[model samples]
Target: MKRIQFQETGRICQVPINDIFGFMYLATFIYFLPVTGIIFIYIAILKYTKRSLIIANVRQLGLEQTRYRRELRFIKRILILISIIFITGVPYLTFFLQVNIGQSPMPSYGHRISFMFLSCGQGLVMLLAIFYADDVRKSLRNILLQKLPWIRGRRIGNIIS
Candidate 1:
């Protein structure tokens, strides 16, 4: 039998994360594109909502104002979420930019920081979601009730909701 040369199943099976080309293309497609799209969508929403409020008839002014306030709050929450995600992603991006591929050892702080962000960021995001989303909270309560029969508690009003 011919000698089987093996390192991986394929020579190019995995893209090195620090590879400049891989990083650029992946970041462009995954990070920049989605972030820019989200920003544009929020901008459009805000502009359209403002226009609608401005053009509201006297009869519907109160309703429009309520709508405007609700939309504004939603937009604010989204902005917070975006900020959190961005903040969490920064260390990784910084590390990516700081390191030259295969030239020197990658910084240990970069790996640590990225790991911390990845771990804590997910929990923070989930907490934000739980706080903001009434349905998610309700579902979690229901699941807890179903899974743990021993726990007995009266129905409680949702403070956030």
Candidate 2:
């Protein structure tokens, strides 16, 4: 049997598959479960309590209402983005738990694809930020146009000059 090497100690430890599964189950139950629960609770508090408070205060701000409303909208967009990230992350977590704790065998391709999906979650958050914020979109457009002038065609050159 091929032994798994420990990276930190550079030691080759012969650990049984069943023991590994038990360790994973305990780790996930003790660590990941509580952490995930806490995050969801925090998000719920932000969405229900803090959001309403901000909206109420923004309403009473009179002259600054427009600015405050815009800021609030941006914050709401960020919250939504966070929620999407958490929702998407559940699948990766589920797959990880199922494979590690449940001792269910996953195909190589399935593992690779699950990892890829998890990696892409951050990219999705960035995309949400870019798409939701007009200021960011404009800034990105300007930077892209400056770096790759050909993207804007002749009209952009004329405008720039």
Candidate 3:
């Protein structure tokens, strides 16, 4: 995976609690990606520009850098897994892009079955990643707390309280 500078830091400065819950609620009203992007930007601004706000809100919200980082990592893993599924399957999908692939635009029963299986595979991968991610995130959070004093116990319970 490509490593970004901010992600390298053990501190997660991404989506805050309000944004997390907001996204959950927004998902009910809006399609996910756009709402998620807006939420991401909102929290990112607070972390980067509104330092005072974070400091003021941190205590009440019980947000620690460690928890933020853990959530960020979990989000990152899910995105990566989804991306991998998309990229790996792109070639197969390209066949549909053409006007013809020695067949009709309408897919055969076999093709539909294959497509459904592929979709299921992607869904399964995402589901597993979602379940496993919590464990991986907690392990990383603990490691960061133990290894980095400045970050250790700095947040509420090393994750979002």
Cα distance off (Å), candidate 2, residue 146: 12
* Predicted structure with the largest TM-score when compared to the true one: 1
Q: Which numbered prediction scores highest in lDDT against the true structure?
A: 1
TM-score of 3: 0.34
lDDT of 1 by residue, 9-107 (tens): 223333444566766777699667977887898899889877887777655888888888888988898788778878888887666656664455555
Error of 2 at 8 (Å): 20
The alpha-carbon lDDT assigned to residue 120 of candidate 3 equals 69
Give the alpha carbon lDDT tens digit for every residue of 41-120 in model 3: 65664455346446646565545555556656655655665555555445434543331445544233333443465676
Q: Could you give candidate 2's per-residue lDDT for residues 32-120 as a string of tens digits?
A: 68557757865675576556666767566674566556656765776676676676667656766776778887444554465467568
Every candidate's CA RMSD: 6.7, 7.7, 18.0
Would you list the C-alpha lDDT of every candidate in the order shown? 0.69, 0.61, 0.50
Model 2: residues with Cα > 4 Å off, grouped in runs = 1-61, 130-134, 139-161
Q: Can you give the lDDT of residue 109 in candidate 1?
A: 51
Indicate whether candidate 2 or candidate 3 has the larger lDDT.
2
Which has the higher TM-score value, candidate number 1 or candidate number 3? Answer: 1
